[model samples]
Target: MEKTNNKHPKGLPYLFFTEMWERFGYYLILGIFVLYMIDPKDTGGLGFLDKTADDIFGTFIALTYLTPFLGGFLADRVLGYVKAIYIGGVLMAAGYIGVGLFQEMPLFYASLGLVILGNGFFKPSISTLLGNLYSEEPYKANKDAGYNIFYMGINIGALVCNFVAAYMRNKYGWGPAFITAGVGMLVGLVIFSVGMKHIRSANILKPAQEGDTKLSTVLLKVFVPAIVAGLIGWIIPGNIFGSDSTDAFIFACIPVVFFYVNLYIRANAEDKRPIGALLAIFAVSLMFWAVFKQNGTALTRWANYYTDRTAPAVLEKPLETLYLVEEKSYESKEVPIYDDQYRAEKNEAGETVKQEGKDIYFRNVTPERKAELEADPTKPVYLFNTELFQSVNPFWVIALTPVVVGFFMMLRRRGKEPSTPSKIVLGLFISALSCLVMVGAVWAGGNGLEKVSSWWLIAAYGVITVGELCLSPMGLSLVSKLSPPRLTALMMGGFFLSTSIGNKLSGVLASLWYGYEDKANFFWVNFGLLLLATGLGLSILKGLNKVMKEKGVQ
Candidate 1:
């Protein structure tokens, strides 16, 4: 066996920053997507109902992840990874710019199409490229660490982009925030181009193996049928799954899911066990994503309405200049109370009825805190942008990645590092534990009858981030490790397909937010889903561990 030094490949930083900027663009838009959609049309928003917004959000993210399957296949066979990434980045940027420039239904949908397509090509290729860079001797030993580092870079973009999003949206409007997202993606593309030299070695395209499935065959058999299924779901009379988009997404997934199942069925014995292990992991991960993805929909609602967002008077004006503060007056006025669909309730006079208050925000404040604020001359409540809370998870990732990496390193040095499968098992249980933190938040907040402290959100995000570190990057590393060289990119795409399913499920779950009159019940449902995932993960642990050992991957 050849022993090599443990220093990381030079390509790491370039991939790191490129992914960071791309995520910045992606997450920035996501941070404010629902908020913008639900805002009044007079405020430059689309005035969508909350359920509708959540549905759109879910569908968008699902499609975004789903396309990576094709992307990875194309990168492996047709376009080299680097070229695919560039194409993806450019398309995504154009989509974001289009979103900012045009808000009408046609252009909006077109832009979304661009982004969905762009993400398909860009996401898997770059990740596959990064995995390839670590395939050599010394770096192979450090693939997990490299992915952890890369994951940190992704969060760095996610962390900072929300502030940018908040500032741009607050100062200019929704359009500019979206435009900024486009610019960030362009910046990412430029950075990737600059570092092309470093990553050139990893851009090798895999020719079709003797038994490998051809791209043409895949497009005709998988994608073509998926489109037909999606169309059928869309045109079907009554909505079986909440809405047309939801039905279409679920319907479309059938073919893709079948394709993966077919992959397992047709796989040779040598590759079968690892593929099965990955498929099991993928199935359980749907629950993880269903819960984790709430950061955009359900969790954002908590930040916007349930949490106390008032800033100190001393920092109010300073924060205001940066567009960090959302200033609202506490004066009495008639405001619409949202219905189950988050639409304003209308009266028999054919006009929207209103109540004698701005929002339930004040009502949720405890008596003591309310009285204290009422006595103050500062009638204008200054709130930190709700989107800013989206940073908490990424912020935790950045702050804790070093610690996580160090802990694993310590274990490695002691010759006791857990196998990748074991780590994933631990991650699932830990993630399930994080949901309990939110359960506490609900109880502490008097079941949404009172505002909770920001510490609750921080704590929840911190716990989940730990689980994310253990599981997410490890999943990437596992796919790279277990996949046969010829099928590496394709398997990477499969990993993302799992994510797509989970993302769509997340939207399905989030759309039920209004259905839970008791907010505690909502968090409990999330907790239950994660617990189910954790149990499923535990049952498969021993088998997955055996497969990893068989594959000679720790």
Candidate 2:
């Protein structure tokens, strides 16, 4: 209810920058995580097989999202949002630094555990705090625009961090690059501390109501059962979901899923409809993330091995000067031999087999380049860093945010703006089309027999980024609008619960990349999944709109 002429709250800019720096760190790590995992051990990587790496990547992201369930609960019931954010930020910083310093698997996993735990504490609290800030006055009507602006801040960080990660990794090696993530996180924490005065009023903690579940009971009922089920899933005789981790994750999710369902079942009459609507939206949106989150896994694989990464002649020298290009020489040495699909050849013992040959990058090169490379074997080919492609989605987000916001504003002025749920459904439909772009990429590249232009990847990311803009931030705003005041953060956790499952599924889908003989089919599957999600959203659109109208929110 504080008035300001800035058209937004005083706290918005502070939260925006705080989240920007935090995402800078998170996205930086994500941009390079899979590449690091699959790189050879000699290069200071885990040297995991692509499938194994995909599994770990999926599980790691899944756990990070999953922990928000407890984090939100604790923030709502015990710790205030500000304290939780500080704790989370420090822990994440330590984790990033630890990852840089350690190489042993156990230590590395421990470091990731720190990040997972830290993100749980950090992620939900910040968004919830921002929502609380918009709970009153003229600000209330502007929640969607506020979240859109905040989302742009997130992408600004995302867009720039990949370049920094590329420069750091290319110049200083993986350790320093990982360590830089920690530095970024610390910087974010510093910003948060500086802006604490501006935002502290928004960090209100609601007192428990009579029917509210106690934290102790939740721990006993939800956490304990989830752990037990996960353990059982892990130790089962045979794999049910293609891997122990997958099985464990799916099994663990059962209890948590049931808990959310139970929350709906037990909700008071007034709270039930809105909670139900949020849950419905959560279920449908999971498919969108299942496809979109693949930018880190399957899509990165396309950029790394399938796309033509040759720097344009005009910019090659400048890129090289900046250390933004990765150079591979045509040296005939004992390196991993890849098949047409770019899978490393493995011996019967499951170890990669190497033979004296040109690098895998040459496998799908044009005939002219192949002859030229063979004639001058010592020549190095300078190409853009594969991780640089990770920036494309964020770049699209930043470039398009203003357009999207303006378009919606125009519609709002004309009394024709779609509700948030409608936008989300439209997003799913558009995101499904991004898969078609990749399918075209597969066709254009002649089914992996040749390298495709990088433009294909860029265009695909462009389309998906549009869908992401419509859905992701809107989901956050929708939660703020519909949630019962005390349960806002908890419902936000439910949104992320959908994201966790989708992330894990993204990994599962990526792991199957090698199994697809015709890569177009892979993208087609993604398209089908999104279509299903879009249809589901449409089916429930009326009911969801009704709930929104009843709640007196758009």
Candidate 3:
């Protein structure tokens, strides 16, 4: 047996801070995005409708996670992990700053493109670097725990960034919040640059395996074909899908998807099973992502519209002083002030929609709250900004990570813990229940005709977070465990591919937000999707757990 330290490595701290700040910035931008868009142009947002926001939101995330495929491959082949990190970090900072500084619609779109491209370079490479660092003989035993800790760093950023984003968006407006995010990224870059010495050893790039195609070969055979095919998909005469952007993204994924197919086809028999299993997991998890990704889109809307977001008088002053709360006046008739920057077209009812001049934020708000604000003559009514809802998932992740990890450890000691696959199956099942919470929230809120308590959203997230803790960290650990040593980098790419696809589907699902008039029906739809994914996962759990046990890991 190898006599290694078997504890997590010194580099874990650096990686932790690196990811913490990186996600801090990334999630900050995301948390405030919808609010910024739907806010009145007079208030500094683009003021788009919910459908438009949903479309762009879906596409933005779709690209953000999708690019990791390109990023992972580039690192595995041409650019080493450190260089990829540097490139990605710089580009992302530039993109964040670009959005903050530019108010023009074209510029905003361009800025999004930069962020998308930059993330492809940034996300997967850093994760791959962490994996590489752990693969060193001395640290191999601790890789799973190390990855979980690293995942915690991501959630910490996610949890805290919302407050930072809320404060900036409410107090200084959207630009400042975005600029703050950009600054966070720059600080992350500086830290990573300073700690270059620590990670230098793990920066080693492996030579292509004997049967593996050369970098040039992949570029020629995969990259070029993808570009050509994607271009064709983009300019096709009519929209086969709902939006041109969706068409373009799907087209773009064709070559990338094909590349993975080739990898599986070409892989040795031993490698194939794990790759096949991962690919299968990735395929099924698309539904999970589609539902889970709604945290930002549909769920955010639920918080903004259906939830009673008023801060009580006792807590209001402190929050306002901290700039965590924003004040909107009913006297000013600040009916969300949805206009050109935030307008949506209405049907015969004159409701604000994604039609162009309407802010979708008003869609789910209980009519009672609306009437109360419209009729109030007393002190100005204050509503909590919608961005605050973004904190729930990460907050849950941070609060639950240690407990979940410890419980598993305790179970391991007693030989009663579930296998990683079983845990994931459990995770899927638990996550399914979160939707039920929302279904109840819908009814509780009187079918979205009245504002419900924020507790509904809180309770739902709390449920899903446990599932997330079980599934998400464990998925990363599973990849490290099952992937063959030689093809680890490529296989990690596969794992992210699953995530990327799921992320895209999440956007696709969100785009349908405008279609569902009854919000509870919308939530139930999400629930059903997760239920299907969960059932599929459990169906395979017997086999997956068998394989995991054979791998001789907990």
Candidate 4:
């Protein structure tokens, strides 16, 4: 019954905070995931090769998004949104905790599977639930703004989680850091439970319509075919996409992609144009994610090895005291000798060969500091934790959301606001510019021969954040506005399916990091991908705008 200034439903703030904490848990794990995987086993990490870690990271994220296809379908027909969310939250919480408690490979994979399955049920349902809240009088016109507001909550959680993760991991080690993520998820569930009463009205379930596809048919046709194709891709492939998991994932997606196409084909006449428009948007936006999602892989690698993370003098003491800084002492000891690309030398047995060597961080250090460290080998250099860079994109999101929201409002008042599809096309172009910034960074840093300022990474994330603000929330809002009432959740899953495919491609690209002798070319490839997406989006913009207008929604 309560409301925010009587402008929105009371449930808005509840859902906002619930998502905030959930993302806190989610991003915390992501910020540390790759670092944990590649860390030496003696330091409580998985000790996997960089290629191996990138492959798993991509597969894990890809599957997380992929599962929503089933999750959303079930929420529409069987479990309902609220029940699905509860089950998902619980599963994710247990998964987070399980990851911390078990380090063996089998147990570790089992835990990740839990998190992937849990995310499937949780992600789409919550977004759909918010759309339902804004479907009625007093709130209908504000749905886009509502999604933007909701999106900021997600960024807020993402913005702050890395610092907590740094403090936890640095102070208590990796296991405790992961456990903190589990605790955050439980807190989110509590908040969601407390606001359940206020949001109950939005939980109305639409019955299956006369022409709706049967659940049995989808299981047999989509799910079964996907499973079979994935197995075939896994067993009969010879690195078609660089790894068995990548091949399996790509093969598995064919059936799901076809399912979405079939959904458009089967839609009633009234819904056909809108569904078709949405499919086009999904296809284009996949490239945006293919480049943007690199924050967890390629960008993270840049932050870890290429960026100069030295804590400034004023902040160094406090950061070290709080355990937010990593210390590396130049000790003369048996250590892995790294090549110019930072990969360790391996013997014929494929084991990393240790010899008297400096830490990899020294490779890009200034000569003066390197000499000073050599003079006092016991003295340690304090640098910010690599995981801290994960917060940059989210920080930009939180800081810029209001500015973006206000800018759109100003345009609205002038009766000149861009349509959602127009904004998305503009977003793709802007995102491509961010890639150019990194190319500049690569040149400025002498192609990783020297460390670059942290500002390069920050500036890149800032630009992409602007594009993200324009595209991501609009994509969600568009689906809600355009999808048939009975099919909203399923369509939301389609949006994420695009993101899943993009995420997998990101991993595939990142796995080729060592293959690029000229790192600038790496970023150039990203720029080209975004530019291609921009061109595709522009080509279809007018048609999509017409569809939106025909649907009587923006």
The local lDDT score (0 to 100) that residue 484 gets in candidate 1 is 77
Per-candidate Cα lDDT values, in order, are 0.85, 0.89, 0.76, 0.87
Rank by lDDT (best first): 2, 4, 1, 3
Residue pairs clashing in model 2 are none
lDDT for each residue of candidate 1 in 1-554, tens digit (9 for 90 to 100): 12335478888888999999999999998999988877766558776767888999999999998888888788778889998998999999999998888978899989989999999899878888888898887788888678778877888899999999988988889999999999999998888888888889998887567867678887998899999999999999999999999999989989988988998999899999989999998888878888899899989988988888888789898888876667665666777666533355544432455678656567678888788767973677878889999999988988988898899999999999999878887788788777788889889987877889999999999998898888887888899889877666567767888889899888889999888877778888888888888888889999999998888879
Write out the backbone clash pairs for model 1.
none
lDDT of 2 by residue, 1-554 (tens): 46776668888888898889889988989999999887766656767788988999999988998898898888877898999999999999999998888978899999999999999899889988898889888788888678878888898999889989988998888989999999999998888888887789899998778756678877988889999999999999999999999999999989989999999999999999999999999999999989998999999999998898888788888888885677888887778867666767655444567888877887888777678778988877788898899899989988888888899999999999999999999999999999999999999888988889899999999999889989997888799899998677578778988999999999999999988999999999999999999999999999999999998889
lDDT by residue (257-291, candidate 3, tens digit) is 88878878988877777776776676666677777
- Give the root-mean-square deviation of each candidate in angstroms: 3.2, 2.5, 4.4, 2.5
Return whichever of 1 and 2 wins on TM-score: 2
Instruction: Write down the lDDT that model 3 would get.
Output: 0.76
Q: What's the true lDDT of residue 254 in model 3?
A: 83
Worst lDDT window (10 residues) for model 4?
Answer: 343-352
lDDT tens digits by residue: candidate 4, 1-554: 33445667779998999899989998999999988887767567777788888888888888888888788788878999999999889889999998898988799999999999999889878988998999887788888778878988898899889999999998899999998898999999899999999888888677778757667877898889999999998998387888899989999989989988998898789989999999999999999988888888899999999998988788888998885777877886677767777765655434567878677888897677678778989987889989899999988988988898899999999999999999999999999999999999999989987889999999999999999989987888798799887676568778988989988988888888889999999999999999999999999999999998888877
Which residue ranges in model 4 land beyond 4 Å of their true spot? Answer: 1-6, 132-146, 264-272, 345-352, 371-377
Alpha-carbon error at 299 in model 3, in Å?
Answer: 0.7
Which one wins on lDDT?
2
TM-score, structure 1 vs. true: 0.92
